[model samples]
Target: MKTRSKIEEEYWEALERLKSGTTKSVDTKSTRFKFTKDAVGREAGRGKGYVRYERYPLLCEAIADAEEARKKNGPATPTANAKLEQQKALKQKAIGDYNQLKQEYDLLMTEYLNVVRRNFELETGLAETKDVKIIRIPNVR
Candidate 1:
């Protein structure tokens, strides 16, 4: 068994490598140990050029490991199903919240785009107006 500090140190070194643009790959060892970019980054010191999970094998292994763990531990006992069901319910609730936030974000983005477009149109119209005059108002004490 690896000590907590050792594992953390490995992860941190790997992340530092990544941040320095030296680390190239995300390796899930044949031993089934998976390391994700976010996981690595969370364990890592912060800085730019932090080559994260972006365009990389990030979620694939950790998710697979979680699924495997879930499958392996699933429901041998009669009460296990109940616990599993509760876990599923919680996961579903989290998914629901994520979807709700996504929808709200999409709506907000659309609204913002419309506002920007309107502002752009207004500005263009104002710019094109021949009768518009610019007058500097002097500050009066």
Candidate 2:
């Protein structure tokens, strides 16, 4: 097994402790000091939020990594997964429709060739009405 670095270990630990609770905190700040607030705010619009970069820098680094992973992977909600599934289904349907059209086009091409061959035979006087084999235009199955 690969060993976890101090920052990575702290990140995992924090993630375990926070779970879904980490989203409740905002990252706002004043120019001088550092603090944080609940997502809704008891401090109203003045959300005193910003951790000192020097203090618990490893944990901060870990949190940054977590946030970066979330940004890279995007939303993991049921709605997002459903959208992916829906897109796959649409692509499959489009491919099926294309294959169906290709088969139909091939059948029509075959009928056209049969008609052209009959016309050619008649024009060359190789086949008269009595000698001609009646080839009906085929219906698509």
Q: Worst 10-residue stretch by lDDT in candidate 1?
A: 26-35
lDDT of 2 by residue, 1-141 (tens): 567666445434444433344432333232221222122222222232423346445545655665566456554445788989989999999999999999999999999999999988776674455676655688999
lDDT of 2: 0.53
* TM, every model: 0.37, 0.35
Task: Give every collision pair in model 2.
Answer: 28-49, 35-49
TM match of model 2 to true structure: 0.35
With candidate 2 superimposed using the best TM-score fit, by how many Å does residue 85's alpha carbon deviate from the native?
Answer: 0.4
In every candidate, how many clashes are there? 0, 2
| Runs of candidate 1 exceeding 4 Å displacement | 1-78, 133-141
* Cα lDDT computed for each candidate against the true fold: 0.58, 0.53
- The RMSD (Cα, Å) of candidate 1 is 16.1
Q: Which RMSD does model 2 reach against the true structure?
A: 17.2
